[model samples]
Target: MDLKNVDLNLLVVFNDLLNTGRVGQTAERLGMTQPAVSNCLARLRRLLGDDLFIRTQQGMVPTPYAEALAEPVSYALGAIHSALNQSVVFDPARSRQNFVIAMTDIGEIHFLPALMARLAAVAPGVSVSTVRNLSIDLPREMEAGNVHLAIGLLPDLQTGFFQRRLFGQHYVCLYRHGHPLDHPGGMTLEDFTAAEHVGVVAAGTGHGIVDDLLARMGVARRLRLQVPHFVAVGHILRNTDMVATVPQVLAQCIAGPFGLSWCAHPVSLPEVSIGLFWHSKFHRDAANQWLRAQIVAIRPDGVDGGRTEDGATAL
Candidate 1:
C-alpha cells in the first residue's frame, strides 16, 4: 500500500480498459505497445490483489473488484489531468474533440437540432454523439469518460455527480386529432384509465415517467401498446385509438406534425425536472465545461427547481 511503490500510470491503463474493454485498444489509446499494456495489467493485478479483468468471448470482462475500482481511479486520473492542463486553452472552432452524450429520444428531438446548429456555426470541427438514457450505469459511464453528459429527467443519480436544472416539464395526454377523447371535458382520469394506452418505456426498468406517476396515485391504464422509444408513440397514436401521456415540450413539437392534439393531464402528477448531469471528475475540464455552457444556453424557460423530500428529483 506504499504510494511510492505503485506506478500511477497503471490507473490510466485501468481506466482505458474500463471504457474499451480490450488491451489492444487501450494500448493504442495510451500510445503504448500491446505487450506493455499487458505488463501493466499484470502489475495492477498484483498491486490490487485481484484479477482485475478476465478475457472472455465477448471481451475483457471486468471482475467485481475492478468495477468497484473504476470510479475512483477514473476520478483521480481526471483530477490529475485537469490540474496538469489547468492552463490549456480550448478553441472549439479548431479542436477536433468528439463528445458523447446520453439522452432520451424526446430530449434529442427538443435539444439536438438547436445544439447542433449552434455548434456547426461556431465549432465546426467538434462533433457530438448521443446514446440512449436507458443506460443503467450512467454515473459509472460518466466517471469513466464514456458519457460526457446526460441530459434528461435523471432522478437516479446519487452522490459523486453534479446536476444543473435545465427545464421543468408537465404531463400532457396526446391523441389523434379526431379521436373520441379530443372533445372538451371528454378526457378525464376515468376516461384515460379506461382507454387503450400507448406506453413508452424509456428507462431500463421498462417504465416511463407517466407510468411511475400513475402507479403512485394507485392507478393503472390499460396498455394496448408498449414501445421502448418515444418516437414511435406519435405514429402509434395517429394510427390507433390509444392515448399517451408525455412531456408537454415533446407534445408541442410532435403533436402538430403527427396530426395529433394534446391537453393537460386530467390527473395531478409531479412535474418532471430535466437536467444536465455529469460526474464531478469532469467538472473542471475545459471542454466539458464549454459543452455544459452550450447546453445551458439552449435551455428553455420555466425550469422547475423543485426537489423531492430526499432532495432528489424523480424522472
Candidate 2:
C-alpha cells in the first residue's frame, strides 16, 4: 500500500470500531453515516489485509490482527487528541490528576498542611504523591513527566528548570528548655561554641551549611552527634543536652511540641531560601499553571518580591 495514498480517516474509523464494536454506534460517535463507517472499515481491511472485525450475534468481535493493532492505534489517537486540545481550559475541581512532587522531608513538614487544605477545599479529586529528592535524577524525572514539581532548596538545577522562591529561612539555635542557655540574653558566642551539638546533614556526608559558615568565621561548635534527617533533631534535643543550629522554620516546627526553645544564632550566616521548581517543559501547561498559582497564592507573606537569577518568582 502507498503510504501517501492511505486515508487517515480510515484509522479513526478502525479505532472507533475497536471501541464501540457495532457499526451503528461507531457511526453515531464519529458523527458519520453507517455506510461511510462501513466503507472506511472495508478500506482498512483491504489496506491491512485482515478482516479486522467479525460480525456475530454477540456483536462485532475483533479478529486477531485487529486485537494486535488495538493498543498502538488507541495510544496514537489519544496523543493526537491531547496535542490538539493543549489550549483547553483546565478545570481542577473535576480533574483526577495525580501530581508528583519531589521534595525533602523538611519541605514536606513546612508545605503539606496548607497545600492539602487548599486541595481539599478546591481540587478535591486531584491527589498528590511525594518523593524525597535526595540523590534522584530530577531533570530526567521532570522531563519524563514523572515529577510535576520539586519543592525546597534545589540549587543544582540545570538550564531548563524554572523556580519560585517561597521564603527565606534564617539560622537559629535550638536546645532543650531547661538545660541552661535559655537565659534572657540568649547564648553567647563562647557558650554556643562550647555546647555539645547535634548536627543534621542532608548531603549524607560532611557537615551542614551552618558548619561551613562557622568555619569561614574561624569558629567551630563541638558536634557530638550527626544525623541525616531533620525529624530526629527534636527527639535528640529533647532527651539530650546537645544543641542544634538549624533553619528557623525547622526549629520552630520542632520546638513547641518537643519542649525545646530557639534563639537567634550567635554567629552570622546566610539565610537559606526555599523555592518551588519545575521543568520548562511544563511552564505553559494548564494544569501545572493551576497548581503553581495555588502555591503562589498561599505563600507565607502573600507578596511577589523580585525574580531570582534563573527567572524564578521571589517572595
Candidate 3:
C-alpha cells in the first residue's frame, strides 16, 4: 500500500496485459520479453496480494479486486498522461487527439453536424466518438474519465462537475404539413389531446418535462406510439398522421424536408435547458475549453438563456 515502494511501470504492464489478454501479446506491446512480462506480473501479484487476472478461453478475466482497481488506476494514468502531454501552447491545426462524448440522439442530431464540420475545417486531425445516453452513473463516468463531455438536459447535476449552458429548447407540435390538423394554423388543447401522438422517452429529464406539463394543464394526449429517441419520432411523423411534440430545433431541421409542419404546443410547456458538462478536473484543459467554445458558438441563437415556469421569456 506504500506508493513510494511500488514501481509505476508495473501498472503499465498490468494495463497492457488486461487489454491484450495474452502474455505474449502484452510483452510484444511493451517491447519486453515474455519472461520479463511474466516476472513483472508475478511481482505485481505479490505486491497487491491478488491474482489480478485469470486466464480464460476468451481472454484475460479481471479478478474482483482488479475490476475495482481498473477504473481508478486507468483514470489516474490518463490524468498523468494528459498532464505530461500538456504544452505551453496548444496548436489545434496539427494536434491529433480523440474526444469521447456522451449525448442523446437528439443532441447528436442538433449539435454534431455543424460541430464536426467546424472540426474538419479547423482541427482536421482530431477525432470524435459518441456514446448513446443511458440511465447510468454519469458523475462516476465523468470522474473516471470514461467520457470527456456529457451534453444533454440534466435534471440535477452533481456539485463537483462544471456545467455550462449551451442552449435552450422549447417543445413544438410537429405533424405532416397537409395533415388534418394543419388547416387550423395552430392546435388547441382539445385537438392535441384528440390526435394520435408519438412520444420519445430518453434518459434524464425529457419524459418528466412533458408529463409535468400535461399534468399542470389538466390535459393528456393519446400516446399511440412510444420510442426511445427523438430521431425516430421524425421518421414516424413523415409517414403517418400521428403528431409528435419535439424540440424546436429538431422540428425545424425535419419540417421542410420531411413535408412536416410545426405549431406552438397547445398547452404551455417549460423550456428545457441543454448544457455541456464535464468534471472540474478538466475545467482548465485547453482543448476542452476550445471544444466547449465551439459548441457554444454554433448553438442556435436565442436558446442559450434560462427559462421561466410559464415559459414566457428567458430569465
Candidate 4:
C-alpha cells in the first residue's frame, strides 16, 4: 500500500466505528450519512487489505489488525490535528486557545489560581480545562496529543518527554482552628496518633505516604474515615475534630478560607515533587515554550533560594 495515496479522513471513520460499534451510530457521530460512512469504510478496507471490522451479534467488532493499529492511528491523527492547529506565533493577548491539563485536586488548589490570574491578565480569551490525573499512562496521553500538559508528582516518567520541576510539597497536619490540638504551640506525634483522623486515599489501594511512614515507625492513628478526594477531607476536617494529613501547599491554601490550622507532620514523610510535563515533540513549539516559561516564572521561589534535588523549588 502506498501511504501517500491514503486519505486521512478514513481514520476518522475508523475511530468512529471503533467507538460506536455500529455504522449508523458512527455516521451520526461523524455527521455524515450512513452510505457515505459505508463508502469510506470500504475504501479503508481496500487500502488496509483486510476487513477492519466484522459484524458481530453485539455490534461491529474490530479485527485483530484493526485492534493493533488503533492506538498508533489515533495518535497519528491527533498529532496531525495539533500540528495543523499550531499557530506560528502565539499572542496570548489576542489568541483564543483551549488547553486541557491533567492534574490532581491538590494541583488545582495550589497552581491553578495563580495560573488563571496570569492568563486573565495576558490572554483573557484563553480557556483551560482540568481533568483527573488517575491514569499511569500520562506519557502515552501526551504523545497522543490528548493532553497538552500534565502537572503532578510523576517520579517514574519514561524517556521521550520533558519535565520541569515546579516545587516540593511535604505533608502537613490540618485541623479546625479552635480544635483541642490548638491549645499548645503545635502538634506532637503523641497528639497526632491520639486524635481521630480522616485519611485521604485517592488511589484506594495503599494508605497515603503519611500513614505509611507512621506504620513503618509502628505508630497507628484512629482513622475514622477514608475519602477519595482531598476536598472532601477538608470539608470533614472543618466540621469535625477529624484531622487529616495533606500536602503543605494545599493545606496552606485552604487553611485560611476553611478556618483550618496546619502544622508540619510529626513523622517525616517523603516530599512529593510536582512538575510540568510535555511531549518532546512540543519542545521547539513556540507557543508551548512560552506557556512553559510562564508557568516556571509564576511558580513560588525556593526556601533557600536554590533548586532542590528534584530540580524544583524547595517549599
**Over all chains combined, what TM-score does candidate 4 have?**
0.72
Query: Model 3, 48-111: lDDT tens per residue?
Result: 9999999889777889998788656765665675586556455679889888888888778878
Winning candidate number (lDDT)? 1
* Model 3 RMSD, rounded to 1 decimal: 6.5
Better of 1 and 3 by TM-score: 1
Q: What's every prediction's RMSD, in angstroms?
A: 4.0, 11.8, 6.5, 5.4
The superposed Cα distance between candidate 3 and the true structure at residue 97, in angstroms, equals: 1.0
Per-residue C-alpha lDDT of model 1 across residues 182-224, encoded as one tens digit per residue: 9987578888888899888776522365677679888888988
Off by over 4 Å in 2: 1-86, 204-207, 306-315
lDDT of 2 by residue, 1-315 (tens): 686877779888887776667899889878999999999988888888999999998779999999888767655654565466569789988999999998777767777888999999999999999987766667656644678888777777645567787888788999999978888898889999889998888772122666777888898879899888887889899999999988898887778899999999898878887778876656667788788878777777677647633466422
Q: Once superposed on the true structure, which residue ranges of model 3 sit more than 4 Å away at CA?
A: 1-88, 302-315
Best by TM-score: 1
Model 2: ten consecutive residues of lowest lDDT? 306-315
Better of 3 and 4 by TM-score: 4
Question: Which is the better candidate, 1 or 4, if ranked by TM-score?
Answer: 1
Kindly list the per-residue Cα lDDT of model 4 for residues 111-178, writing each as its tens digit: 78899999999889888888775654465556545677777775445455667777777888899989
**Alpha-carbon shift of residue 280 in model 1 (angstroms):** 2.2
Stronger candidate by TM-score (2 vs 3)? 3
lDDT of residue 162 for candidate 1: 78
Minimal lDDT window, size 10, model 4: 306-315
* TM, every model: 0.84, 0.69, 0.70, 0.72
**Which pairs clash in the backbone of model 2?**
none
Candidate 2 has an lDDT of: 0.79
